[model samples]
Target: MMKFKFFLLQALLSSSLACAGVMGDKPETETPNRLFFAGLGGSYNSVKLDQYFNPLIGTTNIYNGGTLVAFGTANGPAVPFHTTQTTFAPEAQLGYLQSFSNQDWLWGIKLAYNYLSITMTDSDLVSPQLGTLTAVTGAGTGFTGRATISSIQTRIEHEFDLMGIIQHSFKNIHAYLGLGPTTFGTRTNIYNVTGFADIDGTHVDVSGTPVNFASTKWVWGGVVELGMTYFFNPTWFLDINYRYALSPHNKTNYTSAFAGTLANGYTKSGTLFGTTNQYITVQGLTFTINKVFDFV
Candidate 1:
């Protein structure tokens, strides 16, 4: 009986040791692998006029009934016609990200869309007449024009944490910096009068010669962004970011009839045409909510 009791004690000690060894060899549970996110935000935009000019002349002689009027040097007033514009824009982004480790370092790529609208107003414009009047008339001869710009941007971004988190309750909050190139396309529309008014304030309808312009071209530029994100959950977070264009430079040329009626009873008309090679910088603050899809 003493030998049997000794054997039983030996068996229990071996079993316990085997169990502890198995437990030790088993791997520790890993952090969940979450990786993709989508977000929406709004931004404020400021657009300014870079350059504009218009010039007109009569290509044909004027014949008022049996009188052959000499098409002398008839010059109209030079009117400055443009206004600066500003407004708010709405934007959306979809991104795919992969985390290096639980230390809070992440690298990602994003595709985004932005919508903006700008307005140009010309007030109290003067009509070009047959006589030498070089002053803008106070009469309501002004018109408003608008331009809409949209863009599709592809970006690569990196996220960095100040204090690298290893073991902490609040370790997901961090700051990040981003930069990338953008290709944009823009559309513009202008509306104005064609033809001169008689001395009795009667408009000589010259509908045959109206001005119009349109364009959709690829514009290239770069952008830089800085922001902070708060990770409320393992796979969910919110961020507030500010972005600015590194090079807001572009050139656009357009031609349209502004004023005056043609001398051949077709009403006089002028073409305002020029290219704007100027810098357009914008500041935007946006709030974004994101969800991660882990695949690790």
Candidate 2:
């Protein structure tokens, strides 16, 4: 009976030792769900501006050297002009992350905002007909007049994206690819002036009134990303990603109103119509610190 009791004690001790060794050799597994994240980054954005105006024609009578000269209806270009500008913009995003049962595949949706601005100026002689008339004083001498134009535009983009993501993990480092659909709410304001007469400081007011216009539009787009994450622990990580996004053409209509009397005492009051169709593409490298929590 004594020998049997001693053998039972030895077996129990050997089994406990084996269990400890097995537990020590195995690695700890992470929970399948990561709940929320907030990120900040910089985006390189390109805004394309396509502006076209309808033909503006009018007449004014100016007295030069005590004689009245009549300037008849004149025409401007009907074709639109296009310009592009790039800006380094700051962007912020907030969203929740959802994981699949497989854990290797996940999905997320986020709201992001970016602010951008662009300004361009174009100066040309008022229609050649008008320029030639302005050049001739009542004396028919070579008194030249010229027209100048300047435009300032500001725009903001609010975006939302639904993403499909795949991730591969090696210890604490994880790499991921994300593909998604992006939607944008864009708002823009434009201020412009054409026909400033600065020919030798004579300050002729032949130009149209200063124009203030605003428009808002919605656009559909797509975005893709490749990223890597380094985990500081189970709940904190640093992530860096390269992202690209593009949208189709979207149209905006601008209506401008100007009121002022011309140098010839003619009330230059009227409305001019302009239209723009714009396409935008953006690419950037982003760095973020992500905090993940378990779903309650």
Candidate 3:
């Protein structure tokens, strides 16, 4: 009876050792196989501007032997213009990721593109005799103008997995932060004039010749992004991101025929021509869906 008990104990010990060896020899589990991801998303942007309006001259209005005019108190009828605009922006991205044992932890690099358009218009009408436009030695006058600008940008991003939560039977969710540099290009067009001047029931045509102006500028800056992503499976996910620029926005200078010749000529004549610097800064939020195609 004693021998039989000892033999049973030895067989159980042998079985345990064999099971441990098999487990130790097995390779680590492979990560998800999806690696390449492409997505399209829309973004909303907040753009702010600093604008400069140079001295403008009208053919029919003369003051002090110069077509250019400035009104003190009683500068008769003048129009005021204000504009508001909204844009629909689109984005696309591609990236590669590495995952650790914790599926929530990841590191990756992304390249993205964005396209946006911005438009603005000015509209206001007041009698030239009001306190605003009293200088013209007559009853006051009324005008309208519009301008549009568009741009496309490409950015390279580097991401760090910040934190996440996962359930045994549910999709994985992760939050991350990214930062990188961006390159952008823009085109601007202006379509505007001081409008027709109506003096005491007589319509004076004061439309300056239409001007065509354009410029291209390159901008470089740092960008910061915060995002949340959910994995439908190990290979597919959706992400929502918000990005902010860390550097100053830069724009190309545009020269108008009137501004260059007339304004410069005034300066040469020892008169003051008002010119202000105008620029816009970009800030945005985006949402996208990404699929990872990992081969390793």
Candidate number with the higher TM-score (1 or 3) = 1
* Model 2 error, position 66 (Å): 27
Better of 1 and 2 by lDDT: 2
Clashes of each: 14, 0, 26
lDDT of 1: 0.48
Give all candidates' CA lDDT scores: 0.48, 0.58, 0.47
Model 1 spans with C-alpha error above 4 angstroms: 1-34, 44-88, 99-104, 122-170, 193-210, 216-218, 255-279
Estimate candidate 3's alpha-carbon lDDT, on a 0 to 1 scale: 0.47
TM-score of every candidate relative to the true structure: 0.51, 0.57, 0.48
Q: Rank the candidates by lDDT, best first.
A: 2, 1, 3
Q: Per-residue lDDT for 64-182 in model 3, tens only? A: 44644533221222232223344557777877666556654666667767675554433332223222223445644433322211211222121111222221212366677777776
Residue 207's lDDT in candidate 2: 44
**RMSD of each predicted structure:** 13.8, 10.7, 12.7
For model 2, the stretches where C-alpha displacement exceeds 4 angstroms are 1-31, 41-89, 115-148, 157-171, 181-189, 192-208, 216-220, 257-270
Q: Residue by residue across 172-275, what tens digits does model 2's lDDT show?
A: 67787878887666766555544433334575555465555677677788888888877777677777777777776666665554445666464444344455
